[model samples]
Target: MGAVTGDQTVDQTVVVAVDGGGSKTDAVAVRLDGSVVSRARAGGSSPQIEGLTRSVEVVDALVREVAGVAPLAGVDLFLSGLDFPAEEEAYRQAIADLPWAPGALLDNDLFAVLRAGTSAEAAVAVICGTGINAVGLGHGGTRVRFPAVGAISGDWGGGGGLGSEALWHAARHVDGRGPATALTEGICRVLDVPSVPELIADLHFGRRSQGDLRLLAPEVFRASDAGDAVAGALVDRQADEVAALVTACVRRLDLAGEPFPVVLGGSVLQAGHRRLEDRIAARVHDVAPHAELHHLRVPPVVGAVLRALERAGADGGALARAEAELVGTAHAALVGGVAR
Candidate 1:
C-alpha cells in the first residue's frame, strides 16, 4: 500500500514485527500510520530448542505470510533464546541476509514485554512463561539482562521449573522420601496415570515426553489454592524468584528509590494466581517502594510493532495511533479464538 503526500505518491512504510517465544510466536505486518495489515501465529521458535536455522525458518515463514507483497521498511524481531550479545548478533546477521527486509533489529523477547507494559524511560520486565527471564532499561539508555539459559545460567522458577518440582515432590511422596502433599494425586490425575509409579514408568519409557511436565504447572497453582502446603510453598518460591529478579534489576540500575515500572508478563505470572501476585507485590514493595508493578494486558507483539515504528522515525502521533490500533487488534484476535 502507498500513501499520498502533497502531489507525490509515496509507498507507505511497512514494518514486519515479530515476538517469538518459547511456546509460541506472534507476528504482525503494520503500516507507519498504526494500521495492522496482517497477523500470524506459529509454534515455538526458540533457537535453544528448535536450533538456530529452524527457528529462523519458522519466523521467516510467518513474516513472509504476513508481509505478502509489501516491501518491508523494517523488520523488528524480539525473540526468546537470543539471551546474549553473541546470540543476538548471530540472529541479526541471519535476519539481515533475508531478501524481504533491508535489515533487522533483534533483542531478547523480554524487551517486548518491557515495551508493551510501559513507555517509561526506566523500567524492568520479568517474564515467567515456559522459562523465566528479566530485562531492565535504566537512565541514559543503560540496559540489564540475564543469560536465562536455564540451570546453566543459574535460572530457576518458570513453568518448566515449577512442573519439574511438582514431579519431584510427587515422586518423593510416592517413594516415601518426601512429605505428603496433594501434588502426588493432582499430578497423577492430570496426567491420567493410575499412580505415581505408572506416571514414572510412562515418563521413563518414552510413553510421554518429559516436556509434558510443564503442563502440570497449573496443577501446582490449583493445589496451592486448595490449601496444599507443598504446592503453596512452590508457588511462594516462584513469587520469590520473580521478586528477586525485579529487585536485582532495580539495584543494578540504582532505581530502587526512583519511580519505575516493573512489568510482569508470561503465562505463569498472568494466570491470576492470588497468592503469587500478593507475595510478589509485597516483596517488591519492601525493596523498592517507588516501583510500580504492571501486569501486561496486551500481547507483547505490540511492543515489536512499536519498536519497528520507533526505528522508522515515527512521530508521537504515529506511536499513539499504533498502540491504540495494535491493542484493539490484539483484543479482537483474542476474542475471535486466536490464542495469544
Candidate 2:
C-alpha cells in the first residue's frame, strides 16, 4: 500500500519491511539512500500461533517503532504461518488502515528465504525450523506451495518433530519396546534428567515443558555426530523429509533439468550439519542434478529489504548498496526487544 500525506508526496523512498515468524518479528526502515535508518523486533506475530489480534498488535508495535517519524513509501511483510490467501487477506485488512496501506506487500516468509538465499526473484525455498514448509516460484509468476499446517497437512520434520522423535525412541528404548541405542543416555543427558522415564514423567506432570523438549533438537544432531544410532536415524529421516520437499517443489515447477537455486533456511538446515546436508544434496541431485544449494547465512529480513527496494524502484546501485548495508546492520536489530 502506498501512502501520501496531504499534497506532498511522502518520501516514497523510505521503506518499512518486516519478516514475521513464529518466534519473532523483525522490522526495518530503510532510506532510499541505502541506509537502514531504524530496526526493531517484536514477539511472534503468526496468527496461527499468537491469534489474529495479538499477531496484529505485535507487528504494529515493531513496525511503529522502526518507522519512527518517516512516512513509508512501501511496506513489505513476509510472514510465516500465513498458509492460505485468506490468512494473508485477513492480515492485510487488519493493517489496511495503517499509514502505509496501499503500498504494502505481504507474502509468506518462505519467499523471504528465497530472496535471502539468492538474487533471483524466482526460486525454491525450504524452511525446516520449528516445522517444515516449501515454496517454489517459477518464471512468469508461476507459483507452487504446500499448506504446511503441520501433520494434518501431511507435513513432518522440523526441530519440534525431531525432538519429539528423539524422546519417542528414548522412551521406547528404556521400556524395552524398541532397539536400545545411545539416545537413551544422550537424550537424558541433554535434558539433565536421570532416565527416559523420569524425563517423560516430568514433561507429563508439568515439571518440564514442551519448549524444553524442543531444545533437544540440536542435541539430536550432536548425538548423531557422536554415532548414536537412534539419533543418526532421526537425523537421516529429517534429511529425507527436507530432500523430499525440495525435490517435490522442483518437480512441480518443472525445473528438473535446469540449474536452479534451492535456498535452505532455518536452524536445522542452516546449522550446516554435514550428515544431513550430504543426504539432502544427494537426494536433490538425484531429482534435479543441476540444482544449486544456497545455505542462508544472513537474517531472512534481508529478503524484506530486497522486496522493498524493488517496490521503491531502487536502481541497481541503490539495490546493491541496500543489500551490502543491510547485511551488515540488520544483525544488531535482531538482538533483544521482543515485545511481550
* TM-score top scorer: 1
Alpha-carbon RMSD to native, per candidate? 4.0, 5.7
In angstroms, the error of model 1 at 66 is 0.9
lDDT of each: 0.85, 0.81
Clashes in candidate 2: how many? Answer: 6
Clashing pairs in 1: none
TM-score of each: 0.92, 0.89
**Model 2 lowest lDDT segment of ten:** 331-340
Stretches off by above 4 angstroms in model 1 are 1-11, 329-340
Q: Write the per-residue lDDT of candidate 1 for residues 1-340, one digit (tens) a residue.
A: 6768999876656888899998899999988776778899999998988888989999999989999988778888889998878887777677677886466777788878887877778899999999899999998999998988888888998889999999999999989999999999898888888998888888899998888888999999999999999999999999999999999999999998888888899999999999999999999999899888878888889877877888888766666666667676444323211211
Give lDDT for model 1. 0.85
Write one digit per residue (lDDT tens) for candidate 2, span 226-268: 9888899999999999898988888788889888788889988
